[model samples]
Target: MRLAKYLSHCGVCSRRQASRLIEAAEVTVNGHPANHIDHVTEADHILVSGQLVEGPAPKQLYMYHKPVGIDCKLRPDDPSSLSHYLPPGERVYPIGRLDKDSHGLLLLTNDGELCNRLIHPKHHQEKEYRVVVDRPFDAQFCDRMSAGVPVDGVITQACRVEPVAADTFTIVLRQGLNRQIRKMARYCGYRVVDLYRVRIANLKLDPQVLPAGHFQPIAMTELKLEEEEK
Candidate 1:
């Protein structure tokens, strides 16, 4: 039987957390609450949330250039979306989310394993963006953001904020928090005029490539890096 190790291999969670989930009765075997923490092999039927646990899907990956005024992500309340913007195929979820008001490079994939690995807090995938604010940039604001900014009672992770123009900067983050740049700008007394993600890991969107509402297949090299992260 495949043990909880299989879950870790699938990047569902770290091995330690996987064991805890197993013990906490969050797993199932043949539609029954699977109480055992051992033997997670394929010999036994295993699932989490009614979905098969270890089998792989036909991995599909794409890079979508999200444009401003268009939400690249799916939301129940938002009446429009980029889902209709993608080429026809199996459904894919964003590897990490970008605010609808902000546009940039977004990765969509059906590989849940890589998605789990990339989004998991510990993996620390680097997300880089180009930000334009209405007000002039200040050195002090960059310093504060790089150190840490208090938001929602939690200090955000250290970031690499580099000035690209008098009114623009490149913000690189290891942590993907919801509307983090917008919140950071507000805290810094700047109005975010335009924002776009330029890079995720080694996958860089080509210069002015893939216009808004359009997507293209991603390279296998990028997928390999995500799969191997511990």
Candidate 2:
């Protein structure tokens, strides 16, 4: 794997952070300053900031029910950051982001490859959400949202939108644009009152079992990503 990917797989930091470390000359491979393009094998020795970096550790995944106000970014000094809620001694990072204003299922994992796979736009990973609008909307609203809505000068991909109530609907999206659901609703002349993610791929959030602000370890088998087409 590339040097950055190797560092990420070792749970040292994210691939992007790893790149910065390499650029700052904090990483070394076989006693030489590491290059970003360098690849590693079992025979190579690697170190970060003078600490030997062993091969990747066992991967771990967690299903966290992120609260509405908690920031997804890992900020040790920030009490409201996701780092405050993570398990002690584990260096896992959130797979994708759920904005602080919205809350629901969020996956945290130490497996860098899996994280990249799930969040990459080409994967078309399905994410489902339950949204409540400020005012009642009709079938036309759903049709407009399902067909597509322009966001930031780009048209969003077709998605599944189903109205559950006069002012509430469920939507499934393959794209993960920034605050996408909210933007779509606003474009259709409806303001979102509340938004909650319900599912990501095969993983579903059961509020009763894993209530808000709680999390639990999830097995790799539970994801079943192999069944998904690339």
Which regions of candidate 1 deviate over 4 angstroms? 1-55, 72-78, 223-230
lDDT, candidate 1, 1-230, per-residue tens: 34565665554444555577778888787667766445656566777655666554456779988777766555545666766665585556577677778887888876555666677778877888999999887899889878888777789998899997899999888787778888888888888988889988778877566776688986556654433454
Write candidate 2's Cα lDDT for 1-230 as tens digits.
88898888887766877898899999999999999999997579998889888788889999999989999988878989999999777878898899899999999888877887788787888899999999999999999999999998899999999999989999999998999999999999989989999999999999999999998998998996634573
TM-score of every candidate relative to the true structure: 0.73, 0.88
RMSD of each: 4.9, 2.5
Best prediction by lDDT: 2
Question: Model-by-model lDDT, in order?
Answer: 0.73, 0.90
Question: In model 1, which range of ten residues has the least summed lDDT?
Answer: 221-230
